[model samples]
Target: MALLWWEIFIVVFFVLAVLLPAAVIAFKPQWVFFSRGAKKSNAETINLVRTFMTHYSLPLGMDPLHRQLCLAFMDPFVKTVYSLFAILPDPWMVAICRAVDAFPGNTLRYILHAIIGRTHLIDHVVTEGIKRAGLGRCQWVLLGAGYDNRTYRMAPLRQAYQVATFEVDQEPLQQDKLRRLRKCAAVPPSAYEDVKYVTCNFNTERVQDVLLSANYQPGKRTIFLLEGVSMYLTKEGFAQTLAAIKELCPDDCTLTFDYVDERVINAYNGRTDIVDPPTPPLGSPRSVESTTLDEGMSDCEEGAMVVDKKTAASKKEEVASRASTPLTAEERRYGVQYCSVLERNQTPVTFGLDPSRLETQMAEHGYEIVQHWSPDELAQQFLKWPGGKESKHGGEIVSRACTYFYYCTVRPVRGSAV
Candidate 1:
């Protein structure tokens, strides 16, 4: 049987496209991308990239899907090829990639941290907070957990087998992730015996019901970790969610989460590669739901919105009134929602309040803020980078930017006098 010219060309292309890359990965692996030190010190880097790409793609935002697809395709290839050199064991490499495929947005965030050598900073801070809350032996809840491996990786938690961990998120999303994880990194169920998966939509799930179902007790010292999620929620939605936490947790419970400031959100508005709501109407008050730090004000009292209403209004008016707009294809596709994208295409909406305000709100609701880490302090801690400083992004490094606020709180024991 003689092959036609087109058939011959197709065969050649297929061989080069698929088989060649595989062969290179299996054989001459050292030629693969990434340094040996990087693979060892930051295995989660690739996973972060995968997570970021997944979030960017799954919601069908303004960014070209093709760009995300290309990164997804390239990521596994890099990991596979790199692992053949034994810098990173095959199992670990596969596990990282699988986790990335499981939660792309989070994976990408981790990858960025890895690149910047700041993953340890986050891990350290959270670990300290958890320990300080006296949750070393208590149950831990990871909200929107999304393939986080901390339950297994954090040394203290691993040593305390009495500690039960529950990972909560949407069921379908987790199931799909589990399938991919099984295909790539097939760890035995025994590895996760202390961890349980609770599938629930954050928007609809009854918090009390879910916690009870997960064997959570109200009087126990519990820690809730909410990272990179606040911006996606509406003001009411975010506040109601926190109120539920306060209601369910005992007096010793601690909650830690991050949120962007209004200024950062405004700066990021209309940028491609993000998911945000339409630019809010001019002079619109920042949501009262957020927490801010005001030196002269009592906790919970409203402070100035991080972004001045006049300023935001003027920018919106300018964008709206433009005769020849230069919005990107993604901005056009996603419309106003694209404004939500923050640094590197992640969501950047701030709920409009600061840490002090949140502390005040929590106090009223029976929770008291114990510690607050401002962006300046975090920047000083993380950005020192051994001997010297690195270039700044928009003169607002992650450590110094007013983009996020993190706090720890403990609920008062019932019947205790204020």
Candidate 2:
């Protein structure tokens, strides 16, 4: 029987995920995937990709192949196209591998980095952060973890027999993933004895209750990874989530996650094509001749002619005026406000939790910043592609203009846990 369009698309995607990185490693390793000076060799790239795929193919009470195929196919193409357009600054391939999961293909759940690069970036960061925490033997929690393979892939965690890992998400999604995993990999029960899955709704469910039900103890030192999830939540939700972590885990626990600055969120909101005018305004409707002229212009000139701030703002206001119901007072408050609502009444306001503000918040929450890496600094460290100088338009410039922050923090404010 012939397959459906989406099924064909998914299969083709998996093929590419396996093939593209392999091709890059075999033929154009340096140019296609890595920055100019990255130390990773062709052999390392091939091995890493293969290792990730092998582990990803495993069944840990979840079916991930379908989701993996979807991600393997969609993420790289989207990220590469965006990078080619200079709309994305970070390495697109890395972002895709790090953030894309096998369940819930909702584009809204992932951050810009996730959307434009390989999802493995999160995996890499988390592995590094785990090592930095020096908690090789502690329990680890992967909050909102969707098809995360760290428990299987990371060597340290695999070797630490005493360590336990908890993977949490909404129950329905988790069940769907579990079903898929069972069908695809059929992992032996013994292999997953130390890893547990928990289902909880971050907005309505109590974290403590969920952990206790999953056999997680409040007194154990834990490491938590909350990646590519905060932006989807309201501010209240994020704070409550954090507070729950503090309350549930022992003092020596550590949490790592990423957050976007308000400016970045606003920029993303402004760039969404959903609000684009259906037709040019009556006054500016173009004639055939004008349309021809506009189409004939050089790429540079056409790019330059694209809407500026004033024009964009005017267009937004026009769209707002045309809508039957204008943006709510709540909606107009920016994405952060929406996030604030999710945390319930406990709103911890920081400037995207900038270093200074993060320090203050950590103190109040009985946590301290053990490690912090600014997006700008990370871009500088990882994104080695220098911008094209000869291009008249500045679009080719690889600016470290990221508006997100990633950090790792330890709990209990000052003392080590037994």
Candidate 3:
């Protein structure tokens, strides 16, 4: 007997809901890193694909860059997943992302878009650092660079500055990346002239020694890209890694990274005031775009304040009466939901900074904050562009989640080069 249309639909949904995820997990075990690992570097591949989807679905998607960087690295199974997401309609695809979450706002689409825009921001920051490194003739080092294809994607970088290095902890993922690079004919051997890959556990190994053994030049300045990596580390691990960078590199070196704010790190309830997600300059197409919540405001206490949307709405009058400085109706509902989603994740933020003392704190560590961009700042910048199609999509995501993260570029203080 033939089944009815609704029955068939139910059957297909059941298969996809149960069998598909199980198949993905079994065949692509690395995908688990996207959801529940302490060391989630394994999920970098999954993250890369999500970023690819962000570019794939949007008008501003830099098809060329993502295609060159990500598409070539995906295995057959991953390729199938990518194709499915890419082929589906935008709203339907976005719903697929959102459906993963029980709640509406904290959807997979939001997270994917966040990854895409932020990755673009990182790309721009690293590109600038690369230019500086080229001028200084320093080596480019990507610490904890997981599934990062920047070395392979930017032909100009390859042609101009040849020295590059990618350091990762996991051997399997590193091996897989290497294999994929070899498979993808887009980047030939001549393209990656002086590249090196170092495999060492940052927690236990001396990162300095690992690089030194890899023929990394100690006297030369270096461009360090430490993206999406610090928070997972223990306090001791974080300090040790920073110490290694200080001890090994010269003062002329440039370091670009993003971090969680102390407020978010130690938020007791889901009520931390919004801090802008980290962001970069607006010079390049890939650079982060944003506006200031208030002029010269460095922290939440200043003019830009964030409050829990649900709580603030109920206590608007009471809150306004209690505090001389109260968040506007908009500011409380404003900002990215990224942190709220992160709070729900199994992996918790272990370290963060106090924005008020950022400059001083960095100074104490022999580093100076060259630039800092909050999420609000980034979104404002994005909205300023004339025909920023991608920027609009990315700007919205960041604007919503900006309070959850912070971005900055830091350089070693003179006479304190590590």
Candidate 4:
């Protein structure tokens, strides 16, 4: 009995030794800081996997050579992880990829390809813009730049254009990233020269003040790379950030960012799994139901509105009933599952824009769209699979259906439009 108990204890100890750290990392993004600490995010992990995939996929003659070079500039840990996977056999890799929830089997190929493609497209556009306008006179600003190594990798552009990358996030996360960077052997001392690290919550921070403090010149022609950040912010926060950019950046300064479509946010058109809703303005009435939009006009008039004077669930309900469309059986299932997952993760996606309203929406914030690409457009242009007709079309269909990612470039509209 004593020997059997000892064996069980040893087995339990080993199990925890392997599982505890993995669980911590897997659930890091959902963790609340008690004493101010940085936890891993889904975005960070996606970046790592994407970079690793890029390194592997490059030799396959799938992606552009320059993109492969860019991957070489990634964080040391990312590179190390990629190197480990690169040495692994295809069977082993497929098994590991299959085990991941986000990317199952060969689906990872399309996902990684799309990510790398979008990244390459952005880099090409920005670099070409810089080259055209004279590199030595330009400035590059990567907003919400998390673990992105573009500044360090673009040797020619950085040497000439004088890049200044700013990463704004919670202090704890910023500290953790900087700490990692310091420990990275792949990064050199000179890599620090062109980049400036700024720590602030973008939703609350004054962009003008933050930029000025970071030695950013508002007058200089700048290229703002706002990648993978919009969905994380509320609508007001998104608008405020854009307004700050407009007020602070030069008229010609270009801004590029990706956003999820409003349809996806609302989980419309069979996309019931996406959890998102447009964030209403400040002082907006709170809803008992979080997903529904309060679109009804108030009879109380603007300033005369009283706070609890309206336990008026009836009025709100009437308005919602009038304005809200009924959901289908499929949609209801998708919504329930999506919301359940969202609540479990403790992260609510509260911002999305209708693509049809893109031009008007951007113009409202003093920005005019220069170019845009949908998921289908991106896939048709960039995705290439190895097999025959059936495989290619199937992959493209999967990629096209993924309308969550979009790329758009905009410039500050001058004159009365602002």
Candidate 5:
């Protein structure tokens, strides 16, 4: 049988996305972190690619950014190619997005599992929040904004962007993004006139203080998008930031963030008790015989071959159970390797929370859940389910990091607004 295009694409994706990075981390521990496509921090680069998909014809609808930001972030040559796509009419761009989306077990869904889910969840929150609070009276903040261009897209100069938009991130990252924006020929110097950037280190200064310094008013409804930041933060750092959100506004704010289960944190910390199936490295053989079956297991196999029909049927059932249950171990391996990559880069994951205890944890911080999406829900809601055996193999390789992850939008329990 010949390989399909999607299958070939998957192979390439695994090599560039998985194996290459793993080799780097394994050989170059305690070194700088980056992939072949990276220019700055690996986190920002990856998030930029992921969130940039908001322009694609996603099921939740497209949230487009300025074309120059998109082009400026890419390599000079890649930016030229991206510009070709960016310059296309909306219908053509939509067609291109749909084409990529239709590929079976598409790379977009597998790689973007939790991200797409987070996008959908936050869009809902924003739309609803705008309705209730009125757009002009609300604030929108992107915490740890790393290459995020939402503020740029929603700046009042671009449209009737009534809500105040603020972006908060580390100083170096914000500086780099600003540099790129100013240097891009397609973007005007005044492109960032409307968005306020808050350069912050959450460990020392509180979020409320920094946002206030940036002219973020308290008591009005706010939507804080804390994306892909918690796991990198220490538990104490995460809690302190959460407390700041509470202090910023009461009852009226919507906070969206995601976290991994403690087992993921355990994996990062080199705990062995997780007991995931021993998945082989990408492209490695599935199994190898240590001893000739003819020498040792031949007699057992020959003996078992004479089993009654009932016994053979029982064996078949066991194999079937392996497929439908326990989900997969490959994703778990991906999750572990991801942690390994960051850990080697000296930015190990330190904070995680069990999804079941999410509401409880938020309650302790004076918040209540508005919506929560587990990994299973995210897969079903965002990615395409497998149709048959072929896609089942790809689906089995669904990123385990996504499985451990959980997303939610929560609101304060009481009004601190008055």
Candidate 6:
């Protein structure tokens, strides 16, 4: 009995030895801070994976090159985990992908591609936009580029059309990704040599000036992809970037980006998820409800009653607004988890735009909307097996995530636009 007990104890110890750290990584990310401090890299933790859709979407016949790029950029120690997993049958990868898809991100979209094939749908949109921009006549710029391999991945289109490709990002991160690409891919130098890398710190630098300094031709029609970037920037920063793009590109140039709804911004700030309704200007007639309340009150009571009625109507409006928008720290309980790891790392999500006002907002920057894709629409179009069968659990996942974000394209216009 003693010998049997010892064997069981040893088995349990080994199991925990293997699983405890993994659990810490997945659940207790604060451990990263206590142990070694936040990772010093400016690159977003989700950057590689955001573009690495191909890795998990392998079963769906997605491009495999981005997956290779992701594996290359991973830490050697982390890469070993994937290397070991590679020993399993391919189904394991598909299962992992599905797990990520099913794990709801709520409003913290900085983590997973919760809707599935989101990046790919953006890729498809950009590609189509480039076609419309006219082959060899337009320039393609990727803003806030993070290990983005679109320039290399779209090699055939680039080479055939003589597409002028530029990837703009912070200097250090741009260097890091290039170095990783060199080490990871065994392909010829031509694979990545042609693309220009323009670097800037969005807070302090002008993107338009840098692009021009880097020989970016403003006269050419430009298709700019600013993926996973806006939410990290302040509203002023994003607006300046937009203004710069408008300044740098001529009319009909394209800009593609995704932004979460305002509630996502509130989620990060721990603010009430309720966005106050568009109130009529102060002293605007509070007519119907106020008149109805006055009819029931005596002159002595009328004054106090009117005050109460106004307060009640205000409360009513607030409640009505909050009906669709959930409290951040409460709702799905994601508020507590709202990318807390990213918050500690100093890269917390900070910005979001109201979708209803998006086109009107872009119009302020001399751009007009060309197209938009909600998360559900993207899933409907791309979340299918190559054999044309819709994947399981796609609908519920995407519909819920829909309230979180949108993929939109806007093009520069000559004068005012709406």
Alpha-carbon lDDT, every model = 0.44, 0.45, 0.54, 0.54, 0.57, 0.59
- lDDT for each residue of candidate 2 in 302-402, tens digit (9 for 90 to 100): 11123344644443333223221223333234334334422332322222433324455556666555444444334433333323456442223122322
Counted clashes in each candidate structure: 18, 31, 24, 0, 1, 0
Pairs with backbone N, CA or C atoms under 3 Å apart (clashes), candidate 4: none
Best by TM-score: 6
In terms of lDDT, the poorest run of 10 residues in model 5 is: 288-297
**Model 2 poorest 10 in a row by lDDT:** 288-297
Which one is best on lDDT?
A: 6
Query: Could you tell me the TM-score of candidate 4?
Result: 0.64
Question: What local lDDT does model 1 show for residue 365?
Answer: 55
lDDT of 4 by residue, 1-418 (tens): 9999999997886456433422432333223111112223444544554543443333222244333433443444545444545555654543343233233222112344456556666777677766655645667777777656566567557676655556555666556656665665566657654467777677888777888898888867777778777877889889888887887763657788887655545653446564433444455653423111122212222101122424334433332232222334443443344333334454455676655456678867876665556655565555433345775333332232233456667767666346
Tens digits of per-residue lDDT, candidate 3, 56-154, equal 443434546557657665555556655655655655644554344223333222334345546666666666555644443657788887777676666
User: How far off is residue 373 in model 3, in Å?
Assistant: 1.3
TM-score versus the correct structure, for each prediction: 0.51, 0.49, 0.66, 0.64, 0.64, 0.74
Report the C-alpha displacement of residue 163, candidate 5, in angstroms.
1.0
Candidate with better lDDT, 2 vs 4: 4
- The residue-by-residue lDDT of candidate 1 on 1-418, one tens digit each, is 3568889987886566545643543333233433233321122233433333222211211123322322332345554543332233434443443343223232122223222223334455456545544434466777876545555445345444355677777676456445544443324344455577887666666665787787877766566776555656667766666766767764555566655433234434533453333444457744323322223222221111123446444433332322112234432332222233222233334454334245555566565543344444445444332322463332233222222333333344355433
Report the backbone clash tally of model 6.
Answer: 0
Candidates 2 and 3 compared: the better one by lDDT is 3
Candidate 2: where is the Cα deviation over 4 Å? Answer: 1-136, 186-194, 266-356, 382-402, 405-410, 415-418
Candidate 4 residue 275 C-alpha distance from true site, Å: 15
